[model samples]
Target chain A: MILTVTLNPTLDKFYWVDHLPLSLERAEEEILIRARKSTASAGGKGINVSIFLACMGVETVAMGFLAGHTGQIILRDLLEKGVTANFVWIEGENRTNVTIIEKGREYHPVKIHEEGPRIPSHAQEIFLRKYRRMLKRAEYVVLAGAIPPGVPDTVYRELTQEAKEAGVKVVLHAGRRPLWEAVKVGPYFVKPDVREELMVGDMPVRTEGEIIAAGKRAVEYGCQACLISHHVTGDVLITPEGIWEYEAKVPLTKFKNLVGADDALVGGVLYRLARGDKLTEAVRFGMAAAVASAEVEPKMCLAPAAIEHEMRAVEVQFKEGL
Target chain B: MKARDLMRRDLTSVEPDTLIYEVVYLMEQSGLSTLPVVDEEGKLVGIITEHDLIHAALPEYFDMLHSISFLPNLNQIQKRLKEMAFRPVSEYMKEVTSVHLDDEDLHIADLLIRKRLKQIPVVDGEGHLVGVIRRIDILSRLIR
Candidate 1:
């Protein structure tokens, strides 16, 4: 089974408003806009990857800390989505992230984030122990997203390092600090978005050339493959074997929800890798997954057959020096 | 040399939810006296040994019968063994005394001598299981 870690998983609550029933003029008006509906999903970087992985027919086990009622919902949602959970239970409740939106003019969508439970030293120890056991069972591990408070930034580095030492392949798509630390562990794959690259690598990315250079620098730092992705400019892959780029299809239509597209790419690539697909094939699969995800809102994950159809329009170019 | 230099990196462990019959099967297959019980994270929770299996296999009244010098009933013991097979290893796993990764060889030797330990689970400073130091590993290396 594939292993994914989401240290600070959250219960995301999305509230939709039909209209803003408020008076703009200086007049006494009853201000009330009832929420048309509210929906919740298991939200976290690792959880997102695991959900897509499971949807794509890969056996996946998502590991992390879950606490209280919100945590139980995360667990239940994962089960309902056919993703196996191996969460470590904690005392504090899992965090709840609320997003309120009104129509397409959601210019100021209100978002409330809760601080997750603090994982004590003993619990951290327990999690590390659990991770070790999981390594033996998992062929590929995905370390992603924000870590809860009390977890050292270097923890991701340690885990990736240990996993590499144990000869298991690892894929990391985390935030700045953990990504920065874990990149030095020489994982098989590292996917850092353009903004995140600047945030952690402390490198300026003014142009595509700068982004590609940063990815190359990350490769030099230790990762075998570094994928620097940007929505508009496209993705640059830096690998020792070769450097390549894949631009989004021209005449790109407006995106519905780009939130999970990156995760889909990560999961898509890993799915192929787990199934022993070559790197080039895996990259194409990932691009297809991203395109499929970007075109729609949070819906069904692109199956391999659907990805194959999506890949028809994708264009991959091999990039030499400059 | 410290335990890290001698400890074997090929650690074999089972989770707390592992079944008793499976543990017995693994132990019987590998000829190991015990298997360390680890949680989902590689932290050491407990250890299940052959003795624990034997203890659980016998009827509860065996302790009471031992002082009275009774032969006791053999069929009842067999029935108890069947019942115990369905239980999890966590039910009977013995609490383990582990050594840290940087522990001196002398300390490990002392523990082995006093506790009569055949293998010592080596944990790092953060309490993650790093490796296991077996008596035979030390003996073989010293002889080499």
Candidate 2:
């Protein structure tokens, strides 16, 4: 079973608008208002990963710190969706993240963010203890997202060390200090977006070579392999065998949103890895999942069929000279 | 099964000009612990409940009045009587969280049970108050 830890889970609220202007007094016309509407769902980085894993018929557990009425709603929703959630209840109400989708505009389509709950120290410790216990049954442990407030950047790093000691393959998807700190513990895999790579390593990754080189450097720092995702260029994976690049596939239909693409990418990569797929195949699957997520509506990830279709079309090739 | 289905469609609400005693009497007659207060356009403005009236009737300084010499008993009794007579229903009314009639699809009864809310006001898309939902209405749904 795969164990996914979401430090700060939330209730996601999606608002669908047609031709939403930045600063507007009123909407003049209907502007081809489709049956487009908003929806609220349980969301967070690790939660999305677990949801996708469950959808793919994978055995996975979602653990996190949830609180109040909103937290209850999230838990209920997750249970209804068939995702096993082992949440540590906190004091404050769980935060609600809002995603605004503009269906008409292609360039500026969706805006996604979270006003995540504040987790106290005691709650953080409870989460860590629960995660430690979960690691005993988990084959792969995925640590995702930034540590909520009151949590140190070294929290994931500590968890990575503990998972390593327990002989579990740990995959970390985080940014900046947490990413930098987690790599030293020698996780099985690390996924960092282009921005995270640049911010953490201070490495200029303009081209594929720069990204691959950065991934190699992370491996050299003790990580088994690294997958760096490029926003417009796609994703690149660096392993002991060589470096492989899987260009992102654009779906035929227009993209409704790109909120959960990163988490989807992690889900895909972990799914393939859990199946014992090679590094290249895992990277390809990860890119396919990312594209599939971008194609779906906000807060609703693409089903397995969409990812499978995208995966079938994805092509990966090795580059020369390491 | 949406919030609109379980919401009270025909509601007798009060305007700002309605007397506090009259509002209390209405609650007593209707067997409601709380009532939704609306404006002339029938838009929900506030809410009045028994808890508010009880709080309003509490003496300002019962502690100090109890320490007075000869007239302590008389003063305390007089204060209690004044509080009961002058207490208004508006002072205790709570502000109901408004819900859009067309937007929400979940059953209002289920939401009330889940959120532990006593009452919820239903409003139109333009924010005009249309109806009110009471706990009894939700209970009746369960019974049926």
Candidate 3:
């Protein structure tokens, strides 16, 4: 079974409105804006990947620090969808992240994310204990998402060390301090979260050459493979074997929502890898899943047939000696 | 606190065409008194409740009778349940009133008291079910 760790989980709520007014005419006036549609789901990077894996008939466990009623909802949603939840309960309530989408500009969404609950030392200890036990049954362990407050930045590095010692492949998906620290541990795979910034470590990813350089730097730091997002429709993969660029031919207008596409890519790749597929084929299939997910309104498309149909649109180019 | 803060955001709902047996299984597993029935777009259409189950199990003529002692056997009720087990929830579920997520706790309490409801579904501006608020939730928050 694959193991996924999401330290901070949230109830992701989305509202689609016809028009989002930037300013109010009067401060005292109560302006009531009705949404055209809305949806709520359990979300966290690892949680999303676990859900995607479960949808593809993969055995996976999602571990994290959950709390209060929102945490209960997150667990229920994961279980109902067939992802095993082994969350350590914390003191405060889990956060609720909101996303506001306008009518025409569905591509650009306004996101308001909460800081989430702090992980008390007791909770952190409990999580580490549970994670250690879970590693025995895991073939691949994915440490994804942001570290909650009160937890040390070395959390991912520690997790990577433990998973590697257990002979489990560790996939580190994060950004900022956690990514910088965990890369030094030489995880099996690395996917930096560039939503906040384009730089991976100190290397800027503003150009294609810079993106490849950053990916190469991660691989040189002892990572077997590193994948970085080149753009919305493409990604760069650097490995000891070679470097490959995977791009979807589909137009940007086809995308309805881009929210969980990255998780789908990772989940799809892990699903294929767990099935003993080659890394090249796995990454290709994962890209197709990402594109398929972006074409739908839901966070990630779970249908196997849809992903298979999308595979025809992905183009893979090989580059050796990068 | 407001409805958004107090309401349970984890929605365990079934589609309108979902079979009765599956709904019962979900309700039994989740310990929910009612499950909201949504359409393809997740718009709340109706709700199936324990009361609805009892209403569906009894025969139309049984409403006029005082006791079940007069019945020959309990097979009649069992047969009724078996018949509707594979049927859709839309046939037996009832339309329900819902509160907005931004609605005040006081307003929700007033509605709960006036309508004698055990729980109320919370919706967004588009009438999509976002959460559920139970009376016990309100009382527990008061104590906390």
TM-score of chain A of each: 0.88, 0.90, 0.97
Q: Between 1 and 3, whose lDDT is larger?
A: 3
Residue lDDT tens for model 3, A1-322: 8999999998989888999887889998776779989999999999999999988988788888788788878887987787866666666788998988777787898899999998889668757866876687689999999888999999999999999998999998899888879998899988889999998988888777898898888888899899899999889899988899999999988888888899999998999999999988898999999999988988999999999999999899997765
For this target, which candidate reaches the highest DockQ against the unseen true structure? 1
Candidate 3 structure, TM-score to reference: 0.69
Which tens-of-lDDT digit does each residue in B50-98 have in candidate 3? 8788778987887798567788898988999999999999899888878
Chain B TM (all candidates): 0.85, 0.67, 0.90
Q: Looking at model 3, how many pairs of residues clash?
A: 0
What's model 3's lDDT at A314?
89
Q: In model 2, what is chain B's TM-score?
A: 0.67
lDDT of 3 at A98: 90
- Candidate 2 colliding pairs: B47-B93, B48-B93, B52-B92
Docking class of 1: incorrect
Better of 2 and 3 by TM-score: 3
- lDDT by residue (B25-72, candidate 1, tens digit) is 656533457788877666788888887888777656868776324645
True contacts kept of each: 0.12, 0.00, 0.00
Candidate 1 ranges beyond 4 A from true positions: A17-33, A100-102, A105-112, A193-198, A250-253, A299-305, B1-144
